[model samples]
Target: MMASFSGVLMGNSTAPRHWPAWTIYLRTMGLFCLLWYAMSWLTPNKILLPSPLDVASALRDRIDDGELVANATVSLTRLLVSVSIASLIAIPLGLAMGTSRLLEDLLEWPVELLRPIAGIAWIPLALFMFGIGNGLPIFIMIYTAFFPLLLGTAAGVRNVDRRLISAARTMGIPKGTLMRHVIFPAALPSIMTSARLAVAASWTAVVAAELVGAPSGLGYAIEYYRSMLDTPSVMAFIIVIGTLGFLCDAALRSLSAALMPWANAEEKR
Candidate 1:
């Protein structure tokens, strides 16, 4: 009889524990849905400020027309290519700067001066340099993402523990091996954070570049809708942009967290 009572009590306790998480999730979702509905219904004009439903309908139409996917793919491809180029250039430059004090001193002033300038500020120059093709926006995106990555990698390399370097040297590790195995691992989390920031910056730059002159992209779609006063379509594009940015951020964060589990543990500590 006592065993039966203990088992029943444990089962009841476990059941309540599972219920709380589900209950909280449901309540939060319900609140968001209610707010969304209220905002859509209460807004005055569909053209001026369309409801969520209107945006949904517009998005559906765009998707059905196959324009959204194609444009999105172009934008995404451009973003990826630009970021890849930036990473390749930035990482080597950062390493050189971190390893060589003289080089860092030489570049510091120029970087400090240039980094303050907005990425969009480069658009006119890029347009002039690359003309009105894919290169203009790609250049802007690369510029937007590059500085942060370089600075972050440099900082990370500089911050690597002296003790770790010493230990590697004591173990008869070659200088290259020490850098590859010790410094790189120690600096990786910081570099990952920088990369995440670069991705966001690149995403923003790409849209701005598209707005300036691209014939097709999410940015162009928004510009087109704005010109037409089609609030639903504009809102849809905004949602899509936000969604993509959020997804990129989330994915990078997940990857960073996985690569640097010590970061999470350190946070708790």
Candidate 2:
């Protein structure tokens, strides 16, 4: 059964062959659209689950009115800014924590205490602290993304080949130079994986963060038309949110592939 699914997805070969990315995407999307249309036809409540054509029409209206562009731009910009800030702070702190036992011990209690708290749980307090605006969403997203980045960096650094570190130190390499050349490179793949996770986490959080706190964003727009029983537009915003998240992850994946060719080569092993 798995092979059959793989054959359809990957290629004609039951042995499971490689398929072009576009081919896989089209096949999956086509299947999804078919199922959706079938369900919508049978459901009798088009308002709740409209056909693909209806959703597409709603999407086109958004594009034509400039609402889609404006809201998507705001959400994506906030995503970038929040992830950047998270990486800048979390990655550095992660590196330090990974390297120093004492530092980790000192911060372990607080980090653990805060780490388990969901970002959405912070929304109520954030609303009170930052009010209904950019601050709330940005703060929520930052909190959402920070832990993954920090933990990934720390774990990546800790997992570095100790032999390599010893070899460098034995060669009389300075601490700064050794870290720049060896530790960072060795940890690059883990760090990149963490970055992808952080982006995803941030993206997920942004919707909820925007849904209640933000004045304008995809989430805000979804909630806006939803209040008026605008199901198609709500779904339209949902589709936009999904599509943008895919693009953002794709961009990050491309960046990881481009910047870390060695990681790719290693994975082929």
Candidate 3:
């Protein structure tokens, strides 16, 4: 087993072929493990701070029990589903509102009024309106992601170059074709950026929602650890959440880069 593990590590060429990235990753993992060990060994109190070893043990136990995987899967699923729904509506509505002065004026005040309200604050109202189970957290995630995406989309559409639009018209392009090809593509970078932000926000909102009464999720795990006074578990959960968020953001960024390579020029300019 030990030999196989070593071989696996050595074979991973995809992991930092260079010394710097490899060294940094190794050091980071080592530091985290060391701190965890020291906490477990030196910490006299379990309630205030469980040692790193204890948290690892708990994590292992939970994994064995199949709780961690289940929770994580549930939370991820809720996030994806809710964000999809929100994106479907938000992108189109935002485009319409952004491109049309009359629609923008009509929706602007209502969106502004609602935008000020925090996701957590809406828990009570959501619970009352949508009820519990998965609905509350799903709604919260959608709610958090929706506004940023909508605003970004609208702003992008509004900021489309008039010259390009005029040129498209001169070429006898239909309004729909112009919007589909010229306007949306032009504003894609901004829309993508907002979508990234919205995804991050959605994760935060989902965590908050899970905290309310979620049966299984990272948020539930944190709450469970807190209630049980397991500090290590709490810290572990925090690390997991942060790591997941970072990964999600990185993935979004990668996707944006892939879709809009020209956006890179905008950055250089």
| TM values, all candidates | 0.85, 0.91, 0.84
| Range of the 10 consecutive residues with the lowest summed lDDT in candidate 1 | 12-21
Question: Which of the numbered candidates is closest to the native, going by highest TM-score?
Answer: 2
Model 2 CA deviation exceeding 4 Å by range: 1-21
**Candidate 3 on 20-131: residue-level lDDT in tens?**
8888899999998888677667767677777676667777777788877788889889988988999999999998988899999999899999998888898988878877
Q: List the residue pairs that clash in candidate 3.
A: 36-52, 40-51
- Determine which window of 10 residues in candidate 3 has minimal summed lDDT: 12-21
What RMSD, rounded to one decimal, does every model reach? 4.3, 4.7, 7.7
Return the lDDT, model 2, position 7.
Answer: 75
What would the TM-score be for candidate 2 when compared with the true structure? Answer: 0.91
lDDT of 1 at 194: 92
Clashing pairs in 2: none
Candidate no. 3 TM-score: 0.84
Ranking by TM-score: 2, 1, 3
